[model samples]
Target: DQQVKQNSPSLSVQEGRISILNCDYTNSMFDYFLWYKKYPAEGPTFLISISSIKDKNEDGRFTVFLNKSAKHLSLHIVPSQPGDSAVYFCATQRGGSEKLVFGKGTKLTVNP
Candidate 1:
């Protein structure tokens, strides 16, 4: 069974708009939530993350919010740009585990 899920396979947004990507998980024991962005023909790169203990974490225009009670998390990008277009994956890891479970990914297109 897939532990993490990205309901939307793709999303489109106009340039400079705020983009929101959603993720859900079945495992409540996940201690960390991570978001990765992948460009074409490249490996996914770490984007933002939030610990289960915290509700939100932010870096530049990227922010990740975790809702433990709902087993849900979201990644938000403000002023979304064309360069931000990529496949975004939602991942989770346990406190002491190196193994990461990732969602299939959501393709984001920021139209210029």
Candidate 2:
């Protein structure tokens, strides 16, 4: 059983619209949460991350929100483009640990 989970298997969003993805976890030891985007046949690429001590982190068109009390988090991509279509995985890193525990992932399709 994985500690990180993405309940939604897939998401569809129109281009230039906002896309939101959700994730949940059961591990309290995780001190950092990250979102990774992966294209077919390629490795996951880091999208955005948030520290457990903070509630939100934003970068360019990506934003990550953390809710420690609820053990939940979300990723938001504004003005999503067709190139944004990919599988997004929610992952966590334990304090002082380099290993990352990843969720099954949710496939996001950005329609043009």
Candidate 3:
């Protein structure tokens, strides 16, 4: 089946700390991986992405690592800020199109 899994429904961290979110997939055909962040009443916005050919990708305070052999991926946010408090969704796409299969989502809370 085409299922993306986010094991933890929520994570709490103090400001200026690092926040890590994990995702897993059962389908081997998934070649593109992406992370999206969402605020209340808003659609998810793309955070970071990595292709199956790459092991790591980073953008500013966000970094995404993909372990293709393990079919696992993770998103890391450094010096987590109050602005980072939101729902994070992990998504994967098959080789054909960019359509995504999303996880339930992980809520990240950054304490002041």
Candidate 4:
């Protein structure tokens, strides 16, 4: 059973625009939301994360928003660049657990 889902398999955005990637989870026990970016031939790298208690977290041009009541989360990138093009994975982790449950991922393509 897929606990986490990225409904949109792919999203395309113009360079210098905003990119939004969405995810939903069925497990309410998850207390952490993690976003990972993976380029071709490379492993997924941690991009941004948010705690269940927090509604939003921002790092540089990336921001993650969590809606615990909806079990939904989104990652937004402002002024998206070509380098931002990658497969984004949405992961959920329960408090104190090292295990991460990941969604299939959404491919983001930023055109210049």
lDDT for every model?
0.96, 0.95, 0.96, 0.97
In model 1, residue pairs whose N, Cα or C atoms come closer than 3 Å (at least 3 residues apart or on different chains), thus clashing, are none
Off by over 4 Å in 2: none
Please name the candidate that would achieve the greatest lDDT relative to the true structure.
4
What's the CA error at residue 105 for candidate 2, in Å? 0.6
What's model 3's TM-score? 0.96
- Write model 2 residue lDDT over 45-99, tens digit each, in one string: 9888999889999999999999999999999999899999999999999999999
In the range 45-109, model 4's lDDT, one tens digit per residue, is 99999999899999999999999999999999998999999999999999889999999999999
Tell me the tens digit of each residue's lDDT in model 3 across 1-112.
5389999999999999999999999999999999999999999999999999999999999999999889999999998999999999999999997689999899999999
TM agreement with the true structure for every prediction: 0.98, 0.96, 0.96, 0.98
Clashing pairs for predicted structure model 3, backbone only = none
* Runs with alpha carbons beyond 4 Å of true place in candidate 1: none
Q: Positional deviation of 85 in candidate 1, in angstroms?
A: 0.3
Give residue 66's lDDT in candidate 1 (0 to 100).
89
Question: What shift in Å separates residue 20 of candidate 2 from its native position after superposition?
Answer: 0.6
Error of 2 at 45 (Å): 0.8
Clashes of each: 0, 0, 0, 0
Model 1 clash tally?
0
- Candidate 1, overall lDDT? 0.96
RMSD of each: 0.6, 0.8, 1.0, 0.6
